[model samples]
Target: MSTSAPEDFAQALAQRLGGQSVRQLAAVSGWGRTTVSDIRAGRHIPSEAQLRDLLMSVGADESEIASWQERRSAIITPPAA
Candidate 1:
């Protein structure tokens, strides 16, 4: 998989939000607004489960969720020398 910057991943997740408010997404995902806001703002990279919940709350299908997970992984995992 290709590497992705943290900001790029955050931007892609925000786009998936499709104009939904942080409060709304947090409610649907059973998380706090600040958590959602942080994730959207690239200030946080959530755990895998949290990411799954956030993606699902935004209506992301399994494939989409997996894609996001991959992107997140790319950002966190270091490249080989």
Candidate 2:
């Protein structure tokens, strides 16, 4: 697990996609390269729409998408902290 949920998501995505480049993925996702780059670099935490777009672009299954969403929620909301 990463210190941040965004990092965890980015790491998992990188591993899942193997050698695919972020630029290529961004092209496929119809999103800006910088957005993907920011996400992968842990410089940006995606909004819900962005998350859904990213997961769908990567062909992530329902469960994986849900898991990411849950992780995002947990991180953003925290536990009364």
Candidate 3:
């Protein structure tokens, strides 16, 4: 994966969030707005558990959650030599 993978992941997540604001997502996910903002901005990449919690808080279906997990995995896992 390229260096921009995290940004791409964040952009896709933001799109999935649609019109929801960072504050609203934070309230629903029990996370601070700054955390949400950082995730959305690609300044922070949440752990698997944190990502699952955020996705579940937004009522993400299993397939959607899986897709996000795959994306997150792609970012964290390096390409095989």
Could you say which candidate leads in TM-score? 1
Query: How much is 70 displaced in model 1, in angstroms?
Result: 0.7
Candidate 2 colliding pairs:
none
Worst 10 residues of 2 by lDDT: 1-10
Task: Name the runs in model 2 displaced over 4 angstroms.
Answer: 1-6
State in Å the error of residue 13, model 3. 0.7
Query: What's the count of clashing pairs in each model shown?
Result: 0, 0, 0
Off by over 4 Å in 1: 1-4
Report the backbone clash tally of model 1. Answer: 0
Each prediction's whole-model lDDT (CA): 0.87, 0.74, 0.84
Q: Which tens-of-lDDT digit does each residue in 5-72 have in candidate 3?
A: 88888888877776778888889888889998888787899888768768887789889898899999
Scored by Cα lDDT, where does model 3 land? 0.84
Q: In model 2, how large is the Cα lDDT of residue 1?
A: 39
- TM-score for model 1? 0.88
Candidate 2 lDDT tens digits, 1-81 = 336665776677567655657888688777789987887666787787777777777788888888888877876786774
The better candidate by TM-score, 1 or 3, is 1
lDDT of 3 at 16: 74
TM-score of each: 0.88, 0.75, 0.84
